[model samples]
Target: MTRVCRLVAAALAITVPAGALVAKPAPKRAVAKVDWTRTFGTTSAGGYVVGNPKAKVQVIEYGSLTCPHCRHFAATAVKPLLANYVRTGKASYEFRTFVLNGIDLAATLVARCNGPAHFFPMADQLYATQPTWSGKVEKLSQADQDKLNALPQPQMMVSIAKTTGLLPIAASHGIPTAKAQQCLTSQAQADGLMQMIKGGEELGVQGTPTIFVNGKKVPAFDWASLEPFLKEAGS
Candidate 1:
């Protein structure tokens, strides 16, 4: 028998009565306390901020909804950053939408529709499912593609959102189909996203997943490069 089994058997033999049935020990429950210091809000620049409002280091990430690199970074780096730096009040993180196309704009609209409380979570969900939805658009028929392109920008975005499965993804995130469609068609939301894209350009953002620390752009884009800047700024 294995060492663990032997230990269990020894304990059971010592604790049980001669004629009694052996009872299994209960599973240990996880008791880790959740950290609630992380907070969220919309920025004047039309971005979403998550973490301590008064943190010493400020980290801003310019990301696109349909960008694969952005999706990878969100999946791999964001949670650790939130846990180690943001939760510890060493840094504040902000994510600004840098719409790369009509589909990106549509996705951002649905993500922002649920307000600050749900913004980050919705964005995370969109990034996580980016491949599945984007793949659907890649496989569309030529005639259907042309039809989508023929519509006006707003209508085209709504059509793309529905066709590419983005609407369903949004619906799964507690945004109803009607609400998602309305957000996709909202000119105000579209313009706001556009303004943020322009703002990113003005800040010299040349690509998705651009990192800024304390109002200064980081030379490299990955989390490995960005973390040191955050530590230096926080120090």
Candidate 2:
């Protein structure tokens, strides 16, 4: 019976250290992946920052809300910048509002009225809706324009924001009418925005969409030109 059992076991190819003939291979380790795109922070200067805070490559842009060039940059770069670079935890992006005029000031005020969480999303929407709002501004009557120019900065900003059809955009993006009113009417907030313009000038930013990579200004202003620098920076 023992002889027969030994032969059967051999034939069946079943054996064990305890029960098995072959050892199983160890499982591969899982790498933890993080999507830094959804991570938003505020800089000491109040600019909205996105991505891995400690990433090697830091990107900064001094941009105007009303600038066509800045709108184009938002249209082209926001997605890729957040997804390819920021998502991988390789880089960070910061956008500082540089107000260029009354309309720009009003837009910036309203865009920031909600909170840091809504800032970027609102900025994306604002850029997407730029043409519609700007066109409305151009269609303003001469007398109305003169009246706007005559008013003080705060009230003028409120008027421009309303007349340019920008207030509705703000409302749609989570800013209540009362909040938008407060943003446009607040002297303190308006001064804070003016400080942004001053800060941009101090950085020698002469135009809209001025970008800095790793603390150095890149000569290129658009996304296509900026992508190569980001790649070279390990992004």
Candidate 3:
């Protein structure tokens, strides 16, 4: 089937039964019950971290707000990762910013506006609705587009956020327009985002959704590829 479906099926195959010719139901795999009290906090680099602070395996995902593949991975992989690994104290997960463009930068700012507690959920919302917000640019007139392109970097980001409906998305997630505007205009936030981008570059992140397990780059790019690494590390 499609790539995402294939990836998901492969992921399921890890825990689910492999037989297809037989008519018997597959045996259920037992997942550890989530504690729901796992630690959540901000990393020194401004990324969000969730799970046991001293877990043996650490997963760092460098993702762009504008990347569809990153969104797909988030949708299909994160839930299981959190439940089976992070919740069980087998591994910890962190998300790092890797902005691909101005839109990505703006989205990152808005997502981080509410701080660490809201960061992951806001990020999930942004990725789930990425196409809606990102597609709004194509509907703008040439003059308007040029004006947007001509604004100072911070204001340009704010304008992009408003134009692309990202502001409303933030508001719905508890950040108001005024506060979001402030976040978009914050020089400190901009600097942090830039630094994150630089850090991603130094880590050799050539694309969105680049994952690292225990400081080693994951050779495979999908959930199926990552599962084995997590298992090996956790084991």
Candidate 4:
């Protein structure tokens, strides 16, 4: 059994019916195994970038698209900070995927479906509309257990992603074919994502949306309080 699947099983054992308990199976996917290439500097699909290339502060967020906390940060804090700092070349931001489940991975794929140029915009939209889509996940999952519960599950993911404006962008960008391919099939990229998660752990990140300033970890969420740190990083 893959470590992640075992972890998932351990978690499900508590919430699911007794019949759901079973030996953990290897995840059908080892990690995304796709050929990925970036056509621009500081821009990669399924990733993020902001601020000047020479900016001293490099903030990397390892987030799941479906995570409410991540969405909250994007909506309530990150947006304003991006406008102030990222647009002014004072700080840079990057997002790495950390899939918590099949549904989360599906949502990530949809967010990345617009390639790099539209990735963050799609993500921003997703975060903005998170509550609506998040509520339907359970309803959508139960509608067709076979169709939805199956691994490599599609699970009305497109429907939910569309609510966030990603579908239209997908149509415009030709579905971020290469980027989505990289995310869904590339073992190396998957491993790289895992490494980022490990890096976050080493930095004492116990939850999603942990913020950093100038490569130094910040332990709080209050934007007003973090201003001094941002000022120093921006300097």
Give the lowest summed-lDDT range of ten residues in model 1.
Answer: 32-41
Backbone collision count in every prediction?
0, 0, 0, 8
Candidate 3 error regions (>4 Å): 1-38
Residue 121, model 2: lDDT of 90
Q: How do all models score by TM-score?
A: 0.81, 0.86, 0.81, 0.64
Overall local distance difference test of candidate 4:
0.60
Number of the candidate with higher TM-score, 2 or 4:
2
The sequence of per-residue lDDT tens digits that candidate 4 reaches over residues 62-117 is: 67777887887776667766776666666667776767755566566655544455
lDDT of 1 by residue, 11-86 (tens): 8778656657767789999987545344788889989998777788888999988999888788767777887888
Better of 1 and 2 by lDDT: 2
lDDT of 1 at 26: 95
**What global local distance difference test value does model 3 have?**
0.86
Cα lDDT of model 3 by residue, 1-235, tens digit: 9999999999877754566547987899997676632578888877889888888999999998899999888887777788778888888889998888888888889989988667788888888888888878868899988998899998898999988988888888898999999999999998998898888889898898998999999874666878999989878
Error of 2 at 211 (Å): 0.5
Give the alpha-carbon lDDT of every model. Answer: 0.82, 0.84, 0.86, 0.60
Model 3: weakest 10-residue lDDT segment is 13-22
What's the ranking of the predictions by lDDT, best on top?
Answer: 3, 2, 1, 4
Clashing pairs in 1: none
Off by over 4 Å in 4: 1-47, 141-147, 152-169, 172-192
